[model samples]
Structure formats: structure tokens, C-alpha cells
Target chain A: MAVKLFYEALHDGLEEEMQRNKDVLVIGEDVGHYGGSYKVTKGLHEQFGDLRVLDTPICENSFTGMAIGAAMVGLRPVIEGMNMGFLLLAFNQIANNAGMLRYTSGGQFKIPIVIRGPGGVGRQLGAEHSQRLEGYFNNVPGLKIVHTSTVYNAKGLLKSAIRDDNPVLFFEHVLLYNLKEEIPDEEYYVPLDKADVVRSGKDITILTYGRMRYHCLDAVKTLVANDIDPEVIDLISLKPLDMETIVASVKKTHRVIIVEEDMKSGGIGAEVAASIIEQCFDYLDAPVIRLAGKDVPVPYNGRMEETVIPYPKDIVRAVEDMLALRV
Target chain B: MVQEQLAPTKYDPIDRQEALMLYRDIVLGRTFEDMCAQMYYRGKMFGFVHLYNGQEAVSTGFIKQLRPDDYVTSTYRDHVHALSKGVPPRAVMAELFGKATGCSKGRGGSMHLFSAEHNLLGGFAFIGEGIPIALGAAFAAKYRGTDQVSVCFFGDGTTNNGQFFECLNMAVLWKLPILFVVENNLWSIGMQHHRASSVTDIYRKADAFDMPGYLVDGMDTLECRQAAIKAIKRARAGEGPTLLECSTYRFRGHSLADPDELRDPKEKEFWRKQDPIPKLTKFIQEQGLASAAELKLIEQEIRAEVEDAVQFGEDSPEPPVDELYRFQFAEDE
Candidate 1:
């Protein structure tokens, strides 16, 4: 196993996929000679040349739509959003063209494309720059959303996204770029619709994904010290929600707490909580609580933004409050 | 240097064989669409049946100039374009009827049409959506070193869209082989082109992107053909993309649902006089391309084909209810 940063693992995964398939192309603004805005695509343009690594103008909607067209005729295009927030301009193409084209076209055109970039509650990043579009796009059908929380899974999940026959939206947290972990030397791919059981415990099922997964771990340290052993499950797949894994975990723990960076209104936690109630209603010892960000535009101020986003302490408090409930 | 081809005139250069083929295709489109109007009124087809009544010349003129392997994308008014691209009339009719035998397997009605074999990408209902998709097909052609030129067909309303400018810029920057054909029929539903656009001259907008733009006589098939031939030649030779503004008009309202009353009756009367079908028929006869009897025979044959297509649609079954969830994901063949 070799230690790799989260961004470096993502780069390695994209490079390997491109090398394995000549049809795979990397296209976005600053993705070519500039080496991508996040430096995740560094050294790729030099290796693949302009044909495979293309630098598109900042027309997000058209370029994304163009990539979908290319995918139809036998090309796998990976579109890197300079920032995921900027992709709101491309929501039309992503939803109307990419998301619904195959089904509306009667499956004649198979869109094998991956739209990936870094976006989440950032460290002092402006409201415009910091966006959790995963929630915005989760309601859209025909899209597979995968958010990678660690270095090992970032590489594995990305390769799987590139090879998917349908459109896959790969969400990477901006603040977790430097997180490092050792990964196997051989090429490996993680399933796009599975959750990672980070830690096993009998007390409760702590559900989280992306950046919040690490924050949940921070709270877990205190919980373990206080004799509260909460089971942790990282939901890598945001769209399908991995009902098999989530339901089983809920059945065992009988208590659920969801922590996420997305806003509270119409967020991933709401969907998960609803699914749990619908599927595992009798297994619960307490009502499922969600420690999601406040439903508002993210603030740029360090302290103000922290107020909206849930930290490790908030998760610890929520678990303690839930534990005190006898019903 | 001496001018090799004559300037735009009543009739441009076209051989007898090519002229007959164009006449036949135009007739098929007009006849098929007229049948669609009948079916739409009688409730055989549903949901925004946009008839390509007077736009036959544009579809035939441009598509007839392309190789079968080349790709084409169209807007909601797409049945004529699909027919010109060699999608079978029966299959297209079945699709409009929402039957399983449709080219899109009954999933896509009038607003969406697709055929992988013929490479008709789709019929996008939303304006300005399919241009970038066509640009991608052209990009793939350049990436694979194929001489295939991708063509996108949209109405004058689509010209006002941001995607129009965006795609034109990329097509020039990447030097992709594509043709942005705007069938400027002068109205986007009830919105008049003059009222909606700052520059009603859509072809002139191509100057912003530094690509060649032409204002062609869309009511004349030979003239439209001459313009298409040049653009296709430039694209095939890897020069770059071209924008062609074909000044045409739709004889019917925007869709069957729309009442034919928005435009000044005078405007409709004037365009009706310049209808592409009669113009082509006169040019072919006067130029000694085809005799009156021969043209009549061709029209008769196309009518039978269109009638048989209606029967095929009527006989075809609706997609099974049990498989409603099918085609949403990629299923292994």
C-alpha cells in the first residue's frame, strides 16, 4: 500500500482510466495546460496532449451538453467543474440533457460521462463559491451521485464513475484535498452504490458522507471515551442511499443520527430519515435526528460559516441528547 | 481568379439525377407532414405535433448533401429531418403514434426522435439544446479523424439562445466540422423575429465567431442546395464550421395546438406564394430536369408510402406497461 493525498488519488484514478481507454477525455476550464483549478489534473495535459485533455471555454452549460453528445457517439468525457457552484449554470444541460436524454430518447443514446469537481462548505470560501449542489441534483432521476470521503475511495470511486454507462456526478469535498491514506498498489474500483462501514458499534448508527464523515469521526473519539460506542457508516452513494447497508445498520443499532454539510431543507438526511421510517419503522428506539447545515447561503466569515455548519461538538451533543430519550 | 460557380439565382447548379432526388425527398416530407396534420386533428397522435409543412426544402436541401454516416440533430419539429436522414417513414410514424415500433421505441413522441443506425441524434423540445450535442458529434469526428460533418437544425427562435453563441464559438475554436443551419421561418410561436432579436440577420451573428455565414434562398431548393454543398465541402475539408441562415417560413402555425392567427394575414399570404414545393416543381420543369408526368408519378409513389406508414403506426402496439421502468438505465443487450 502507498500513501496518497485525496486529490492525488483522484488524479491517479483519472490518469489510469484515460490510459486504459483511449476514448476517455478530460474536458473543462483550466483542465489542460493550467492543470485544473484545484491542481487535481496536474501533469495530465502533458501526458495526454490536447486531444484527450481539452480546455473548454467557461460556457458550462454548452460544454456539459457537448460532452453528453460526445458520450452518445462513443466517447467517455469527464467534465471538471472549476467549482461545483459554477455548475449551477449547467443545471439545465445536466438535468434536461444529461439526466433525461437517455430515457426520453428511449435509451438509444447511452451517455457514459462523469461530471466531477470539489464542492462543499469551504473554509471562508464565499457563499457563491461554496455550494452543496449534491442536494440540488439528488432529486433529479437518472443521475448517480457519489461523494468520496477518503483518499482510498476517491481513486476507486472515480474510476468506477468514468466507466459507468450512465451519467455519474462525483462530489469531492474541497477541504479534504490533503487527507492522506494508504491504498493498494494494484488497480481497484469501489462500487458506486455502496456505503463504507467505518466503525462498528452497538449503541447507534451514525450516518454521514463526504466531509462530514471525518467530522463524525472527531465526535466518535469523544463518544468512545465517554462509553458511547456509536456505529459509523459513510454513505458514499448519495442518490441510491444504499438501503441494504443503511437498513441493516438501523436494525442493529435501533437509533439513527445523520450528519451532512448540505442544507437542512430537502437535504440527503431528510431523504434518508424518510427511507428509514418507511423501511425500518419498528427498529427505532428514538426519532432520527439530522445535524445538517442551516438552510441558508453559506457565509464567507470564518466564525459565521462555522455557526451554520455542524462541527464535531454538535454531533456529540446530538448523540447525547438522543441517548437520554427512553422512548 | 474567375468565378467557378454562378451567383445565387432562381436556379443554382444541380444535375438531373440530384434534382429528381431532391424533388422526391421534398415531396415525401410535405406529404408525410400533411398526413401528420390529419392524424393530429383526428387524435391519432398526441402532444405538440409540429408539422414541417413549408420547411421541406431546408431538410431535403441540406440532408441530401450529406453521407449516410454523418450525424444530424433537430428541434421538436423533427419528423421531416429524420426522414431526410433516412429513418424509415414507418418507424418514424410509429414513434409519433407512441407505438413500440417507433424509432425511439415509443418512448419519444413527436418532440424526440432518435436512430443510432442513421445517426439522427435526437429531437430536443427545448430550443438551443441540441446545438452543443451536434457540436460534440463533430468533435468526436475530429477526435477520431473521420471526415463526418455534424449538422444541427433549429428554428429562428433558437438563434436568440445563448447556446447558439456558445456552440458557434467552440466550433470555431476547436475547428470542428459542423454546420449551424437556422431554418429562420420568422416566428417562434407568436413572437415575431423582428420584435425578439436585436439583429434579425442571424447569419451575420456568425461574424462574432469569425466563421463563414451565408444568407441563402430557402424557398428555392437549388439555391439552398448550392449553399449546403459549399458549407459541407468546407466542413469536410477541415476548414471549420459555417452558419447558414435559410430564410423560410412555416405555412402552418407553430404546432397543431396553436391557432393559425398570430401573424399578419398579409405576411402569411406572401409566404404562401413563395412556398418551397411549387417553387421546386417549377424550377425542375423549366430546367428540363424532370417532365410533368415523371414528377406526378414521384408524388403518387410518395403518397402510397405515407399511407402505408400510417397503417404501420395504427397496427403497431403500445409499449408494455410491465416494462415502464425500462430504458431509464443502461440494460445489457
Candidate 2:
């Protein structure tokens, strides 16, 4: 076992993949020479050379399209966007091009590509830099969306994402990178599209991912102290959601609470909640509840932004409200 | 001083069979566009339909010269490109009909036609986006040591995009086996090329990228074929990429919805007078490639083919409502 931070795990995973496969290359702005924006790709360019670790011009759409093209031509490209917020500029290529190529080609082509970057609010990075776009991407089809909340899962899931014959949008929360966990030393992979039962219980189901996964875990502890056993499901992959696990858990508990760091309206939580009601309506004891960020621009202030986004206390309060409704 | 190795090929004597195939492709492309125009008017299709009514020679001439196993990538004005690559007209019509039998299972309409069998990468809707993709395909061809070349087709407007220059630089620098074909029609949407571009001559733009460039009369099918054959041969032989500027015109507006009044009435009449079909028909007749009766029979055959395609599209089933969420993953779990 190895104790490593989430960022370190990502670095190790990328290094291992690059060494393992000559076709695996990393390209992005400031990823080469200057290291990564967060120094995650530090010393990569020197080891791998400029051909593999590329420094692209500030054209996000071009680089994104180039990455797709590279992937189409039998290269596994790990494209890094400086921040997830910048992914908006490349949305056309990601949504229209990368997302459609595999199916449009009738499975003759596969884009084994990984587009990764930091997501969610961190300090006072303001509106553009700190926005959570998981929900925006969740609306797009033909993409596997993954959010790594733990160091172990980050390495395991990223390795799987690189090896998978699909385009994956790997969301690394800016706040969770420094957080540490013990990861196995041996090579392993955690399959995408399946949710992890982070903390299991029976009284209620708390579905969440990314930084909010930890927050939900904290909330579950509080709920336990108040004599409630809240089951926490970490949704690693958001698009091809393991509806089986969600519906099965919902059927057992009969109550659901979704926590997301993104806005309440049109959030991924809304989709999951809607899916639960549509697929397992008869099994529900109560309406599926969602504890998401308030529908507003993310604030720049540290404390105000923290309050606006979903917190452990928010999840606990929502669970308490749901329990009262059941009574 | 011109380098002998980089010079354009002299005109060659083409066989009668090759002549008929070229003529057939031009007619097929025109018929496909004509059907798309009528379908859009009848509300049988939705979204932007960029008809290639007056630009048949460019798609026909270029694609006919390439091997079926070679690849092609292009922009939104691509119903003709799809037809030229031998995508079933019925399948294209079904796509326009948004039916399950369509090329992309009705997920992608008019601008996004993709035929993997013929190595037609896709008709990417975004301008200049397909160039690098084509280059990458060509790169793969080179890497695998295949006798395949990838041709990228785009309109005059795409030259103004940043990716155009970037792709040109990379494709030329790396000696990627690709051909960049510019269907330089006078207008892009509503703006004239002269008004939109810093330098209106597209071939000169190719020169700046350190690659050989050629200017062809896009209205003349023979001229287009002559230029394209050389460029395609160059790319396939690993001689590096070439840029061909096919100066063409579009008889219709950019899309079915575009009420184009931007151009002079005289300019529109001038290009329409040089319609590719009539030009090719004259060549075929002047050279005695086919008799007048044979030409009439060909026209009848094409009309019948087009009508059958439209019927196939109309009779095809619409994509099931549940399939709206289909293809989200490779397999539905």
C-alpha cells in the first residue's frame, strides 16, 4: 500500500500509462516545460520528450479536436484542460465530434481518449474558473463522465479510463487533489459506469460524487449519531449511471437524497432523481430528494461560496426533512 | 523558379469508361442535392441543408480519383461528398428523414454524414475542424504503410479560421499524406469571400504554408479531375500534402432557409450559366463519349434512382422514441 495525494496518484497513473503504451501521450496548454498548472505533470516533458508531452497554442477547440483526431488514428491521448471551466470553449469538439464519432462510425472507430482537468470551487477563483460543469456535460451523449473523490479511485479509475475504448471526461475536483488516501501498489483498475458503495447502510440513500462524496460521508456520520443509517453511493461515472444499483438501493431504503456540487436546476442530481422516479416509481416510499447548490452564480468569497454549495450539514438537514415527511 | 518535382501534371487522355463514371458522379451529386432541396421545402427534413447544386465538379472530380479504401473528411456542405463516396442515396435521404435506417441512426442529419466502410470519416459541421482529422487519418495510413490518402474538403470561409492555418502547418511540416481541397465559392453564408478574407486567393494561402498549391476551374469537371488526380497521387505516394483551390459557385443560398440577396444578379447568372452538368454534357457530346439518346437514357436512369431513394426515405420508420437516448454508450445496459 502507498499513501498518496489525489494529484500524486494522477501523476503516477499518467506516468505508468505513458510508460506502458508508446501511443499514450499528453497534450495541453502549459502541460509541457512549465509542468502542469497544478504541477501534476511535473518532470514529464523531460522524461517523455516534446513529441509525447506537447505544449499547444491557446486554442482550446483546435487542441481538443486534435486530440480527438489523434485518438481516432490509434493514439491514446490524455488531453488536459487547465481547468474544467475552459472546457466550454472546446464543447463543440467534445460534444459534437468526440461524443458522436464512435457511434456515427458504427463502431468501426473508437476514441480511446481521456480529457481531464480540475473542476469545482477552490478558494476565490471567481465565477469563470470555479464553476462546476458536470451537469452541463451530463447532458451530452456518448461520453463517459467520471469524478474521482479519493486518491485510490483517482489512480484506478484514470488507468481504466485511458485503457477503455471510449472518450472519458475525467473530472478532478480542485479541492480534492491535496487530500490523501492509501492506494494499492500493484496495477489495478476500477471499472467506469459503476457506482462505489462508499458507506453502506439502510435508513436512507445518499447519492453523490466528487468533493461532495466526502461531504456526504461526513453527513452520514452525523446522521448515524442521530440514530439514522444513511447509505452513501459514490457515482464514479455519471452518464451511463448504474441505475440498477441506484434503483436497487432505493427499493431497499425507499428514500433517496442526491447531493451535487453543481446548480440545483438541470443538475446531474435532477437527471438521477428523474431516472429513479421514471424507472422505479412504484418502489419509492417518498419523492426522491436532492440537496444541490443554490441556483446562482458561484460567489468569489471563500465563506459565501462554501455556504452556497452543498455541504455535509445541508445533506443532514435534507435527510432530517425527508425523515420528518415520512413520519 | 518552379521545382520540376512540385509542378502540376500535364493533361492526360482519359478512357471512355472513366469519362462516363465522372459524368455519372456529377449527375448523382446534383440529383442528391436537388432532392435535399425539395425535401426541405416540403418539410420532410429539418436543420441546415447546404445544397451543392452548382458545385458538383469539386466533390465528384476529387472523390472519383481516390481509391475506395482511401479516406475523406469534409465540412457541412456535404450531401454531395457523401454521394460521391457511394453512401446510398436512400440512406442519406433516410438520415434527412431522421429515420432509424439513416447513416448515423438519425442522430446526425444533413451535415454529419459518416460512412465508415468507404473510409468517409465524416462531414463535420464545424468549418476547418475536419482538416486535422483528415490529417490524422492520413497519418494512420502512413504509419500502417497503406497506399491510402485522406482528402479534406472545406469551403472558402474555413480558410479564415485559425485551425485552417494550424492544420496546414502541421500537415505540411510532418509530410502527412493528405490533400486539402478548398471549394472556394464566392460567398460564405451571407458574406462575400472578398469581404471576409484578408487574401481572396486560397492557393496563395497554401503557398504560405510551404506546400504546393493549384488553382482549378471548379465549374469544369475535366479541369477539376485533372488537378485532383495529381494531388491525390502526390498524397498517396507519400510526397506530402497539396492544397487545391476549386473556384466554384453555389446556385442556391447557403441553406434552404437562407434568402440570399447579397450577390449581384449578374454574378449569379454568370455562375449558373456555367453549371457543371451542362459543361460536362457538352464535353461528353463534343468528344462523342456518348450519343444524345444514351445521355437521355442516363438522365432517365438517374431520375428513377432519385425517386426510389426518396420513396425509401419516406417509407422508412422514424427512430423509436426510446432510441432518443440510444447510442449514449456502445451497448445499452
Candidate 3:
């Protein structure tokens, strides 16, 4: 195993996928000479040449639509959004074309394309740059939503996303790029539809993914000191959500707290909470609670950005409050 | 003399066999669309069914020249383009009928015809959205080091769409093998071209991308064919994309729902006189390319062929309800 940063893992995944399949390619703004805004595609241009590592103009809709077309013609194009937030401009292309093209084309085309980039609140990227787009793209059909938190899973999940025949929206948390972990030297793949049970406990299940998973784990430390053992489950796949793991956790713990950086209204947490209630209503000892991002736009101020999204303290309070009901 | 040389059949732009093939497709398009009008009126087809009536020349002129493998992306008014690109009329008709045997398996109705085998990308209902897709196909051709070209067809109104300009700029920048065939049918549904766009001259927009652009007589099949053939040659030779604005007109309303009173009767009469089908026939007779008897025989054959397509559509089964979720995700074959 070799130690690597989160962004390096993603880069390795892309490089390895491209190396394995000549048909796999990279396209986005500044991905060629500039090495990508986040450097996730660094050195790919030199290794794969300009055609394979394409640098497109700042036409998100056009490039995204074009990538969908290339995927239709049998090329596996992994389009990186310079910032995942900026790709909202191509939301129509993603929804109507990339997501629906396979179905709309009557199974004639398999849109084996990956749309991945950095997202979530980060150092106050303002409202536009800082966004949790998982909420926006979650409802789009024929798409798999992956949120990678660690270095190991980032590489494996990203490689899996690249190979997935369906269009995948891989959301990388901007804050977690520096986080490091040891990944196996040999090839590995994490299934797109599975959840990772980070920590096991008999108490409430703290369901979270992406950057929020770390926040929840941090809260788990305080919970552990307080003699409250909480199960932590990282929801890796946001769409085609890992319901089996969630159901098992819910059945075991009988209580749930969903933490996410996206908004409270119509958020992924809301969907997960509703689904848990639907599936395991009888098993639950207490009502499920959600700690999600505010409804308002992510503010530019660092302190204000922290207020909008969940903090470790929020998760701790949620765990304490839910456990207090049983007491 | 220059005008005479540019006219159809005057100098035999195509040989006898090619002429017959081109004429057959044009006839097929015209007949198929006429049947569509009948089907729509009879309540056999639903939704916005845009028929390509007067613009048969534009579809035939460009797509008839393409190899079966060459990609073609069309607008909502796309039945003819699909037919010209070699999508069987029966399948096109079946799609309109929303049948299982349709090109898109009845998942896509009239406006969204798709045939992967024919390389007909799809008929996008949204203006200019189809351009980028066609650009991708061209990009794939170039990336794969093939001489294959991608042809995108849309209307005059779609020129104002952001995707149109975005795709044009990128196509030139990437030096992709693509042909942007704008069928200037003089209107965008109810909006007249001059009123909708700042540049009334649509082909001039191509100059913004530094790509070669041609303005062709869309009603004249020979002129449209010549411009398209030259553009295809440039694309296949790796000379990059070219834009051709074919000034055609749609004889029918934008959709079946539109009342036929938006345009001036005088202007309608003028375009009616320039109807491409009759023009081709007259040219053929004048140049002795085919005699009247031969032309009549071809028309009769196309008429029967169109009737057969309608029968196929009528006889085809509706998509099974149990398999409603089948095509959502592709399974391992």
C-alpha cells in the first residue's frame, strides 16, 4: 500500500483508467496545460496527448453535451468541472442528454461518461462556487451519484465510476483534497452501490457521506467519551443509494441521524430520512433527524459558511438529543 | 448562363443512377410527410408533429449524399432527414405511432427519432441542443482518426440559440469534421426569421467562427446538393467544418395544431411555385435525365412505399407495459 492524498488518488484513478482503455479520455476547462483547477487531472495531457486530455472552452453545456455525444459513439469521456458548482450551467445537458439519452435512444447508446469535480462549501467560495449539487442532480435518472471522502475510496470509486456504463456524477469535497490515506498498490474497485460502515455501534446510526462523514466521525469521538456508541455509515453512492446497508444499520441501531452539507429542503437527507421511515418504521425507537445545510445560498464569509453547513458540534448535539429521548 | 449552369440537371451534377437515388429519397420524404399529415389529422399520431414538406430538398440534398455510417442529427422536423439518412420509413412511421418496433422503441415519439445502426443521432425538439451532440460525433470521428463526418440539421430560428453559436465556435476550434446544415425555413414556428435574429443573413454567422459558410437555394435540390457535396468533401479531407444555410420554407404550419393563417398568402404562393419536388421533376424532364413516364413510375412506387409504411405503423404493437423499465439502463448483452 502507498500513501496518497485525496486529489492524488483521484488523479491516479483517472490516469489508470485512461492507461487501461485508449477510449477513455479527459475533457474540461484548463484540464490540458493548466492541470485542472484542482490538479486532479495533472500530467494526463502529457501522458495521453492533447486529444485524449482535451481542454475545452468555458462552454459547460456545449462541452457536456458534446461529451455525451462522444460517449454515444463508444468513447468513455470523463468530463471534469473546473468547479463542480460551475457545472450547474450544464444541468440541462446532464438531465436531458447525458442522463436520458440512453433511455431516450431506446437503449441504442450507453452513455459511459463520468462528470466529476470538487464541490461542497469550502473556505467561503461564495454562493456560486461553493455548492452542494448532489441535491440538484439526485433526481436525474440514469445517473449514479458518488461522494468520495477518503484517499483509498476516491481512487477505487473513481475508477469504478469511469468504467460504469451509466453516466456518473462524482462529487469530490473541496475540503478533503489534502486528506491522505494508504491505498493498495495493486488495482482495486469499490462498488458504486455499496456503503462503507466506518464504525459499528449499538446506539443511533450516524448516516453521512462526503465531507460530512468526517464531521460525523469527529462527533463520534465526543459521543464515545460520553458513553454513547453510535454507528457511522458513509453513504458513498447518493443515487441508487446503498439502502441495504442503511436498512441493516437502521434495524440494528433503531435510530438514525442524517448529516449532509446540502440544503434541508428537498435535500438528500430528506430522501434518506423518508426512505428509512418507509422501510424501517417499526424498528425505529425514536424519530429520525436530519442535520443539513441551510436553505439560503452558501455565504462567502468563513464563519457564515460554517453556520450554513453542519459542524461536528451539530452532529454531537443531534446524537445527544436523539439519545436523550430514550433516557 | 451562370444561372443556367447552377440550375438542376442543366449540367448533370450527378450520374443517372445517383440522380435516381436522390430523386427517390426526395420522393420518399415528400410522400412520408404527406402521410404524416394525414395520420396526424386522423388522430393516429399525437403531440407536436412537425412535417418537412417544402424542405424536402434540404434533407435530401445533404443526407442523401452521406454514407450510411455518417452521423446525422436533426431537429423536431426530422422525419425526412431520418429517411434520407436511411432510417426505414416503416420504423419512422412506427415511432410516430408510438409502437414497439419504432426506431427508438417507442420511448421516443415523433420529435426524438433515433437509430444507432443508421448513425442517425436523434431528432432533438429543443432548438440548437442537437448541435453539440453532432459536434461530439464529429469529435469522435476525428479522435478515432477516421474520415467520417457528422451533419447537423436545424432551422433558421435555432441559429439564435446559444448552443448553435457555442458548437460552431468549438467545432472550428477543434477542427472537427462536421457540417452545420441550417434549413432556413424562413420562420421559427410563429416568429419570422428577420424579426427573431439580428443577422437576417443566417450563413454570415459562420464567419464568426472563421469557418467556410455557403448560402444555398434550399428550394433547388441541385444547388443544395452542390453546396452539401463540397462541404462533405472538405470535412472528409480534414479541412474542418463548413456551414451551409439552405433558404428553404415549410409548406405546412409549424405543427398540426397551428392555424394556417400566420404568413401572407402571397409569400406562401411564391414558395409554392418554388416547391422542390416539382422543380426536380421539371429539371429532370428538361434535361432528359428521366422521362415523364419514368418519373411517374418512381412517384407511384414511392406512394405505395409510403402506404406500406403507414400500414406497418398501424399494424405494429404498442410497447409492452411490463417492459416499460427495460431501456432505462442498458444490460449486458
Which lDDT tens digits does candidate 3 get at residues B160-229? 9889999999999988999999999888878999999999887788888888877889998888888777
For candidate 3, give the lDDT of residue B111.
90
* Candidate 1 CAPRI category: medium
DockQ of each: 0.78, 0.31, 0.78
Model 1 spans > 4 angstroms off: B1-6, B10-13
Model 2 C-alpha lDDT per residue in residues A9-117, reported as the tens digit of each score:
9999999999999888897889999999977788999999876887876767767887787677687889899998998988888987788877665454678889999
Could you tally the backbone clashes for each prediction? 0, 0, 0
Q: Report, for every candidate in turn, its global Cα lDDT versus the true structure.
A: 0.92, 0.84, 0.90
Superior by DockQ: candidate 1 or candidate 2: 1
TM-scores, all candidates, are 0.98, 0.85, 0.98
DockQ of 3: 0.78
Best by lDDT: 1
Please give, for residues B22-111, the per-residue lDDT of candidate 2 as tens digits. 888888888878888888889999989889899999988889888888888878888889888888888888888888788767877888
lDDT of 1 by residue, B80-172 (tens): 999999999999999999999999889889999999989999999999999999999999999999999999999899989999999999999
What is the clash count of model 2?
A: 0
Q: Write the per-residue lDDT of candidate 3 for residues A1-327, one digit (tens) a residue.
A: 889998899999999999999999999999999998888988989989999999999999999999999999999999999999889999888998888877877889888999999999899679998898998999998888999989999999999999999899999989898998888999999998899999999998999999999899899999999999999999999998889999999999999999999889998999999999888899999988999999999888887777998999999998899989996
